[model samples]
Target: MSGRLSATVVQQCVVSLGDVRTRIDVSIKRRFLADQDRVYPGLECPVPNDDTVELLSSVIDLYGLTREVLLLEIPSYPRLEGATVPDSGGSNSGQDQDQTDGHPFAVLSEFRERMAK
Candidate 1:
């Protein structure tokens, strides 16, 4: 089967904390095979196609599939229009205080480093 998904989403800029308009377009393709009662000796491993799926149930989970595809298409990090992001900056780089002491895994990290040496 073939289908299309189109949506407009407002995303935030990770660096400048500004709004960004994003458009999502996803093309869906899927194939369902017949019931396999038995598996014979195959020539090498029988790898299913990326677009192929087994139709075991009578109903297809369209909502679940669409949600998964949307999650993949959405950007994890977004940038604002004309906003300059500092290369060396991190989440708390703009703050004056040292953040190393407050990190949750600092002790674990130190232990790991000592083990590495």
Candidate 2:
């Protein structure tokens, strides 16, 4: 069995000033199997809902898996280059230092000094 699913969703634009609309298209193919323990390369196994190990009692449904995969793949936070959040009247701005080339361990200097006590 083969089927396609399409949807339109509003997602934060990664390069624009406003929310951007996106369309997602997915196609699924059904495969019949007898043994559930058989490993298939390049294919994802069915995700279980709980601790129950339900064997071949369940058939592999690609459409349901595709929706779950799409949800998992969506970014939680999307921001454009150089995008900065508006200050809410706070004393300190939440800007991070430019440490692209610098070492991440540089911040450990303060901890090392405190530990010396």
Candidate 3:
């Protein structure tokens, strides 16, 4: 099967937690074999070296395939256009302080103090 997929999806921005709209257009080409074992006799389950090849079943799950393809195409970390997260430069704010407290050097310093005591 060969076709084109076009979709528009709204994803949350990883940094700002804002809505990020994305347009996806993908070209798909695939070949499915009737019998997988016949293709590779000795192998328990032969994985196709080429991504476009696969084993065919009685039913072709086009919906599942489309979903999987769309998911892979979608950005894992979506960022809205012109949306930026300000960096907290070691401020005494609660969240920043909590993050800094988890630093590796901070743990080492605490360990050293405990050892000294």
In terms of lDDT, which candidate is strongest? 3
Each model's backbone clash number: 0, 0, 0
* lDDT of candidate 2 over 1-117, digit per residue (tens): 456667777787565556755667876444444443465655666655542232353556555666775785466666655667665553222443444226677557756988999
List candidate 3 segments past 4 Å from native.
36-48, 89-103, 107-117
User: Model 2, poorest ten-residue lDDT window?
Assistant: 91-100
Give me the overall lDDT of model 3.
Answer: 0.82
Q: Residue 105 of candidate 2: its Cα lDDT?
A: 74
**TM-score top scorer:** 3
lDDT of 3 by residue, 1-117 (tens): 999999999989998999999999999888987685676677787565998887798899999888889999999999988887786654345664675565747656656888999
lDDT of 1 by residue, 23-111 (tens): 99989776765445433344354547664475555687889777877888888988877888665664445452265647866557667
Q: Could you tell me how far off, in angstroms, the CA of residue 76 lies in candidate 1 after the best superposition?
A: 1.3
Which of candidates 1 and 2 reaches a greater TM-score?
1
Better of 1 and 3 by lDDT: 3
